[model samples]
Target: MSVSNPTLITFVIYIAAMVLIGLMAYRSTNNLSDYILGGRSLGSVVTALSAGASDMSGWLLMGLPGAIYMSGLSESWIAVGLIAGAYLNWLFVAGRLRVQTEHNGDALTLPDYFSSRFEDKSGLLRIISAVVILVFFTIYCASGIVAGARLFESTFGMSYETALWAGAAATIAYTFIGGFLAVSWTDTVQATLMIFALILTPIIVLLATGGVDTTFLAIEAKDPTNFDMLKNTTFIGVISLMGWGLGYFGQPHILARFMAADSVKSIAKARRISMTWMILCLGGTVAVGFFGIAYFSAHPEVAGPVTENPERVFIELAKILFNPWVAGVLLSAILAAVMSTLSCQLLVCSSALTEDFYKTFLRKSASQVELVWVGRAMVLLVALIAIAMAANPENRVLGLVSYAWAGFGAAFGPVVLISVIWKGMTRNGALAGILVGATTVIVWKHFSLLGLYEIIPGFIFASLAIYFVSKMGAPTAGMVERFDAAEKDYNLNK
Candidate 1:
């Protein structure tokens, strides 16, 4: 079960190139700003691709395709929900958050922005938000590790423990060296590789399985339920699937791209590019899974043990469809997807620790260089924690992703959305929303309540908590002034 020499060489070259990019980015990283936010200098294309790459993670390749392979078309609602949510986040939250964060004390992290936005002198807002980020991101980071482990085990036939370390090593190295700039630059390349793999794999699968009609007929003959979109469609299922979009407004990694954009003006263009890439990539991901069903129907022998581990569909398909060298390159795209998102998550976790905790509480007078090093140290720490969590071979990448995704979306989504659009949102209201949303998610998920996704209940409760609490509390004149100024500046910029 050894890896082919050609595949090993391709992987080595890819990993080496990533490390080189980290070394190069090190020259430009002179301050904490540069280390955490790329010095707020990313262009539209890089911002769009980096954000998309970080948002998709290995779930885009492994978790997503696996879901479709196992569940048929009912799983696609999640994709549709994500596309719609992404568009709205870029449209509504991106420009406003960019201008607002810079205006409100030049806040760097999400917690920094939240504390400054409400003028929470007691630091309660900062503490709550930072804890939530660390907690959910730990789980989110574990999902990426699981995806990477699955990729290595499937492609190279390595033990899960060996594959877990191998998958995390390169990502942690680059992030430790270059920070945000390294993450963004490598993400651009990874994003390109991801799209190429998603697009090319499906096309090859279709060709090898004959035409579209023939593929469909074969799939239908094998199992008519595979093509039935309505087979498992229910009100709860559809809403829960589409609710995935709502999580976008609150995702710290994606919002970091907006905050780091060159200017508010660049966001519109970035949104268009990001959305286009997302649609094509998501469609391609679903196609790979759907086509795998057909291909396996025709040539079941090639599927091997994928019936038990359906996530291996993409890996198995590539091995059967392409030459050894080309298949190696295609498989490397999975690693690209894994690394791109894992690096960003680790960086965000670092920023939350360094900026929100260390700089704010431990040493308000710390030098920029000192803070940057602390950030790099935290990156390694968080990656190690995630690696430990991902050591379990039975973890399903999608299951981990869904839990963490719901946590972030429920905890932060309603508060973030309300903070930007509504001027009357008080500090107490923000605190209440964070606590209620996060608590609801934990409780709902732990108990497996009502046969519905935790996000639906968590999001509703959080939003309700914010509204009612804000109504009960009074906003200060200073808070009103700050909101007005942000709104005016946003309008003027537009």
Candidate 2:
């Protein structure tokens, strides 16, 4: 496939800039702690943007805009749910987790945090949580890869198979090189590019389609119901869509940002900055699709790609509407979104294997330098697995994301949230919640039961299991004492 020289040059520059950032961060990384969590030294802006960028992923630019393009506003329940969930997570979970992870022995990963919080002597919590992270994160990583592949396939005219590998290459390179600091630093830049594209593309789209009113009229003329939130969906569908928010609690990549903040106080300002950025990006994403509808409806002759796969609406429109140079910059935003999230997910998976598994079981006395190298190796290993998962051309980014999101939300959300906030929650309770939540999501998704999203059932059941099982058992004195110290520290910090 012949590519536009301008776009090809832009992509080259963008990818190089990302790698340069990774190289810069490599100098700051000296130990396993630095590699995995930046030694918890991230300031407010870096922490906030990294959290937001990593959380959004390619799904923000590709899957989400595609979903809105095909299903109209009815699909935005996920967006609404996500915005609400993220805000709550920032408010309730961020500070507590930062303080708790520190007090719990300077934990670097979610599984480590869980194991330390519950005082589990048997290593069950660490094993199960780490496995869940690996399992769901593999799927989550695949979604980012698929989104990147789609972007590459459409933009550069690469075949699906070629695009899959090409799409994951840059992300894996930098993540392997720079570790957490690199991922976090690059994320801030990517987040800026993403917001720029999202904000700019939509305004251009609006102008191209005449205006907001004209766009609405075009949509209304085609299908008035397109503007309706519950247009073709059942109440169950609405509930399912909104359930996406619950996944925020269990996302390891986002939580890692919270844990990496310079201080608990940093989280306060980071929350405000993150939320503002998120709201703007999401609003702009919807605008891209909403306005694309009008622009395409009037120019059906050039809408073949979008008509064939609605997910390509943004990609197609970006190329058609902008000058070649501007289009190159706008299109790089998709790559930015893909790299930001994929890098962090790779780092989190790396952290899980290195901190939760290898360091814990293989070499209890492993050197910091050895552990950092091991983390870098794990990032490559997981990226390969995810690339294999994304090899199929028919895979949809949103579909892959939904399953993984449900899995994490169900398996880790209740456990993480309850463990930090409640002192009386027992080890057995945490274990039960993890099992029940993960099982429910897998089983519910397999059976297609109730036409409801799995996260809702999984979250509810997990929360219930923790409550009942904790009521049945009690925590040890040491457990309570540890919780008291963590809680007191959190209070003082907050």
* Predictions in order: lDDT: 0.91, 0.91
lDDT of 1 by residue, 42-142 (tens): 99999999999999988888888888888787788999999999999998999999988988888899999999999999988999999999999999999
Total backbone clashes of model 1?
Answer: 0
lDDT computed for candidate 2: 0.91
Query: Model 2 segments beyond 4 Å from truth?
Result: 1-4
Model 2 lDDT-worst window of ten:
1-10
Q: How high a TM-score does candidate 1 get?
A: 0.98
TM for every model, in the order presented, reads 0.98, 0.98
| CA error at residue 249 for candidate 2, angstroms | 0.6
What RMSD, rounded to one decimal, does every model reach?
Answer: 1.1, 1.1
